[model samples]
Target: MKTFVLTALFVTIAGLSGCDRSSQGFSLPQGNAELGEQVFVKYQCLSCHTMAGYETDTENLPGSMETPVALGGQVSRIRTYPELVTSVINPSHRLAEGYEAESDQSVMPSFNDVMTVTELVNLVYFLEDHYELEPYPRTDYVSPH
Candidate 1:
């Protein structure tokens, strides 16, 4: 009777511990960030979202989107690997700032179906490491009159 009670308690504790974690028991892949950068540009993610200050190498990759977007509240808030993965997989979950509206929708294409599991993990890491919402420069673009 004592052994049964102890086993039950152990099982209950393990189950409760798993419930508190939000990663759904998945681990990130070990892809090279340099390779991930190539994949990112090849996949054309640089077309819409701009990193805080780092400019895209346009000489090699001509015809890329030149306009820099303001990384506002929504972009600034994400600070974890899971958060970045969520943003990529489920873009509609958090709308980018200045783009929150029924009509001004997300231009970020749904790659959930296209990107492989490895690619997804690499992409998440790349984005998380490169662009940050906090400590992000908020330089305003001024149009010359």
Candidate 2:
């Protein structure tokens, strides 16, 4: 009976421990938006991404017939800080829907080697700040009876 009680206790502890703790107590450094914009320019991100209310001289870069990803606007949903961080650190984690089949690989180069942690945090802050929630359009159609 002692062995059975011990086994039950071990099972209960293991089950409780297995609960998700992936993001528990995790935190990123707070960043300054102004400095982040400088980081964006210094990294020449404007070559591919279009930032709302910001302009860059991209005339020298080769023009692509394809539309570049527009970074800021009234997005359908808010992008969390962690998502932005992951995008920078692991660009190919998941391709932004339509672009997946276009190329087997991500065109975005990982800045993990070039950027400091502080710069990354700040850039994410800047990008996240630009997105605003916009209401989805109401559907007019009703299900046929």
Candidate 3:
């Protein structure tokens, strides 16, 4: 019962205050977050960051709120979309707070060469649309014609 209460409280707080998220990536997708879940799994993203609320049996995930290594648990410093995007593209740019600098040696693999631009955008949509975050400014990183 305590766990359930804690979880609900956390969700409520996260939703009310937001996750302090910001990004300079592509525009959010019109696709459903439910559909984006499919895109997320299809792209094999669970290998790294936790997909909040989403879970799977194959890997023994316990939802994002319970994940010990969730970004929220690690980095209170991050609060921007560009920061989030940089975390994805150039993961080596910043280490989440608390963990040692070399922690990346074991966590968050390099995706610079793996994910293509289109896939990156879709993945971002899956995150922004599906996950909750603290309020922050919005900025577009997509290039203009």
- The alpha-carbon deviation from the true structure for residue 93 of candidate 2, after best TM-score superposition, in angstroms, is 1.3
The candidate with the higher TM-score, 2 or 3, is 2
Over 26-137, each residue of candidate 3 has an lDDT whose tens digit, in order, gives 2322324455566568755664445456453336432322333443322324444455566677766665554434545424556668676666655555565544443654
- Using lDDT, give the best candidate's number: 2
Per-model TM-score, in order, reads 0.54, 0.70, 0.47
Candidates ranked, most accurate by TM-score first: 2, 1, 3
**Can you tell me which runs of candidate 3 are displaced by over 4 Å?**
1-36, 56-68, 71-79, 101-106, 131-145
Tens digit per residue, CA lDDT, model 2, 69-139: 68878887887778888888998888865555345566667799999999997898798888888878557
Better of 1 and 3 by TM-score: 1
- Name the lDDT of candidate 2: 0.73
TM-score of 3: 0.47
Name the candidate, 1 or 2, with the larger lDDT value.
2
Q: What C-alpha lDDT, on a 0 to 100 scale, does residue 113 get in candidate 3?
A: 81
Candidate 3 residue pairs that clash: 18-133, 18-134, 19-133, 19-134, 20-134, 22-80, 22-81, 23-81, 23-82
